[model samples]
Target: MNLALFFDPLADEAPAWGSTTLGAHAARFVDTFPDWRSADLALIGLNEWRGSAAGQPAASAPDAVRQRFYQLQRGTGPCRLVDLGNLRNGLTLEDTYLRLREIVAALLEHNTVPVLLGGSHDLDIGQFLAYETLDRPVSLSCVDARVDMAEEAGAHAEDTHLRRLLMHEPNFLFNFGQLGHQQYLVPTSVLAALEKLHFETLRLGEIRADVRQAEPLLRQADLVSFDLTALRWPEFPGYLPASPFGLTAEEAAQLCWYAGHNDQLTSIGLYGYRPDHDLLGLGAATAATMLWYFVEGYYHRRNETDFTSRRFIRYAVGLPGNPAKLVFYKAKRTEKWWMEVESLADSSVRRIVPCSYQDYLRAAQGDLPNRWILTQALLG
Candidate 1:
């Protein structure tokens, strides 16, 4: 596919001499967009903002975020990155969505990760659609201040996009998780609906207490859609209906780092940025830094998944009344933990999922860990 037809090449002039600026190292499809099927990472900016209730203009966010992102220092490791420029908005919102879905699907087919710079939270629906186009069963994670499931009359797409995603036909979603959601801002009915589906929802308080607790949750996601409003106003002043409380800037970056390390994750969309509302580009800088850390983690990925490898240490503990033993595997290299879930219909078929050291301790105490129970429930 000729991606150039769908995108406008980045036309920003490189800043004056700097040894460490990303513009010096990262490859860009500026003058002429190239065939990016072989690149390790590809960035595409979504300029459409019609989904936002704030009434922001369409197709203006990609470059705003890029101005800050391209100025940051590049990492030491080899990063085969390409900037595909901003996507051109279609005549209708639906048309814009279809264009995004096609672009994301193509990137995933070539084993390239797509990092999307967004216009609003609703753009995530398109990102979710890409996974369906590939016919891959996936788990989705959202970082937002409120559940975007509100279905109201004359609401913007951001308000009801998740509703559509959840009800879409030919459902292939294996799991769904939400992080950093402010309880008071979300409706009780929405929370109840998610609970009925056995979906995971981590409140802001839970995440703030210990950020590492979010790693395993993020690891399960194949695609992550981060709503910038999840950050407190002091840190991200560009988000609408800005709240006084949300994730710290550091915590937001940490979550992105976790997403980058996951071998299962294929795409990430950073949404809810409005440059017009920003306080002297603070929001843009924060978003860019988060993107930097994500890319840094990506380059550091170990890509180790096989439990059968000799590099893994296996542990088995017998529960008091259970006939079968609970098994866990810890990687010798990264020291990450994974628990095995046997298929009830076929014992030979077992799936390994990310777990914590605490889960191992719980299993050793003859208690059924929640992670294990949840995985089993989802598998069923």
Candidate 2:
């Protein structure tokens, strides 16, 4: 698998030089990662917007520099050009999504794990669709400061990406690191819609207070989508409805690392790397570090467990003195995983599932065994 799949959709002037669009930091992220022997890295260059998410086709040089880029990435990486530019090839929404679905399907079918460097976060819609085709269902985890699920109140274009994604299908999503949500900017009806659904959002305040607290919610995630705008000011400045509260660069890296540790996670994508807003290469550099942690975390998790699927099981430590209440949750396969949320009223006694941590940690889904139910009563 190529480590660095570089795609430059902004050909106007080229960010500044060396991935100027993503910023100098992006170049550094690419260069430094290879030094440590991370996964193989491939840079796929694409012509400027031939099509926006709206599918507006633009121009490209069939024989231009991008053509050379396309050729170089073919045999060099885990899969074809990580296909970063959407509009450059797809002139309309359907056109883009269709091409993306095929491209993503091929990579995943062959188990070529991809780390998407998107032209715009909207490109994420294609990535999502690709995995939806998989026989095994996948979980989506978003790390951003804003809840991008707002509807297009007549506004069109790339801005409405998250809004479109939520409406497509019923998929498991975990929105992490959201902050700076302004009522004037995002409609409450949209938030209400999300509530009607069963997705969960972890706000910035909660994470800043304690990152570890979110671990239980993320343990079973398979794919992680990161929007750079979630970082606090000075670290990331371009977020919509920019907020003063957000994760620090170090925090983002740690979060990515933890995400990597999730045995079920398979892919990651980093978006919104606009060099124009980032004069220096700080943002790209930060992103590179975050990616590095993801790699490290994955490696660590891989080493911690035996390869035999039967030996590895999900693990969890319930909050002390909670309740025996249980809620069933689903995993990728026939396995069973459950969540127990109980009120500790004076903390007389409460017991949830009683099983080996090794066993319960790995259970993805199913009804609790009769013995487990009896154990809750015994402990209570």
Candidate 3:
């Protein structure tokens, strides 16, 4: 595929960066686009913002984010990075989504993770659709201030994209988990509906109490979409309907780190940044820092999925219920945990799902863990 035809070269002049900076290490699109096939991670900037309620173009948002991202220090190890430049917006919103889907699918086919710098949160619909060609169900995770399930007349894409994803045909979405959603902002009916579907959701307070608990949910995700609106106002002032309360800047970076460390996670989108709304550049700096942590965590991955290896310690807990026992594995090196769930209809089929230590404790007390129950329900 001729990738250059779909993208326009970055508009800004390349800034001179120091030897230790990310700009010095990354292959960016200035005069030439980078070789994406060899890159471990590819950055694609979306210049289409018609999906936003404002219907205003965020033409400079990606470059604003790039300005801060390139100035950061490089990660611990050698980084194979590429900046593919900005995706040229199409004549219609759907055209832009199709372009994004094709680009993301191409990158995924090459086993390269795409870090999308978005024009709006709805672009994740394109990111999600890219997985359809894989011919298997995928788990999705999103961090947002509110669930974007708006069904009202003439709702903007950012407001109604989640509904579109959940209702997309071919039914390839295996699991959907939402993090950092504020209860008051979300409709009761929507929350009830999501719960009835057995989808997982963690309120802002639930996550803020212990951020580490959110790791397992992300660990199982094939893709993650992060809306900058999930962060508190002044901290991330570039997005609309700025809130006084939301995830702290530090918490947002931690979540990104966890997402980066997940071996199963393939693509991630950072969205809802508007350059016109940011005068102090705090939002850009925050987004840049989150990206930096994600890269740092990516290089530090342990590849601990091989449970049969000597590096893992296995434990079995007897249950009083129909499924007589629960099997758990703990990674000796990283201390991460996983539990096994046998299919209800077919005992021969089992799934190794990421879990927290708290889950193990719950099972030891003869109570089923919520994650275990949810996974079993999904399998059934």
Query: How accurate locally, in lDDT, is each candidate?
Result: 0.86, 0.48, 0.91
Candidate 3 regions with alpha-carbon error over 4 angstroms: 57-59
In model 2, which runs have C-alpha deviations exceeding 4 angstroms? 1-88, 169-187, 237-243, 303-380
TM-score attained by model 3: 0.98
Comparing 2 with 3 on lDDT, the higher-scoring candidate is 3
List, residue by residue over 56-118, the lDDT tens digit for candidate 3.
Answer: 653478889999999999989688989999898888999898889999999999999999996
Shift in Å, residue 276, candidate 2:
1.1
Question: What is candidate 1's local distance difference test score?
Answer: 0.86
lDDT of 2 by residue, 164-262 (tens): 666666653423223323344456775566554544456666777777645544554566667676787588653334566668888888887777667
- Taking all chains together, each candidate's TM-score versus the true structure is 0.96, 0.59, 0.98
Candidate 3 backbone clash number: 0
**Candidate 1 lDDT by residue in tens digits, 1-380:** 87789998777576663767876766777787866798888998887877877776533666778788888888856878888888898898899999999999999999999999977788888889999876767899999888988778898898899888888889999888889998998999999998878788889999999888899889888999999889999998886666899998999999999999888899999988888778588988899999998998888888778789898999998988642689999989888888997766667766788888889999988997887777777777
State how far residue 203 of model 3 sits from its true place (Å).
0.7
**Judged by lDDT relative to the true structure, which candidate is superior, 1 or 3?**
3
Q: Is candidate 1 or candidate 2 better by lDDT?
A: 1
User: Best to worst by TM-score, what's the order?
Assistant: 3, 1, 2
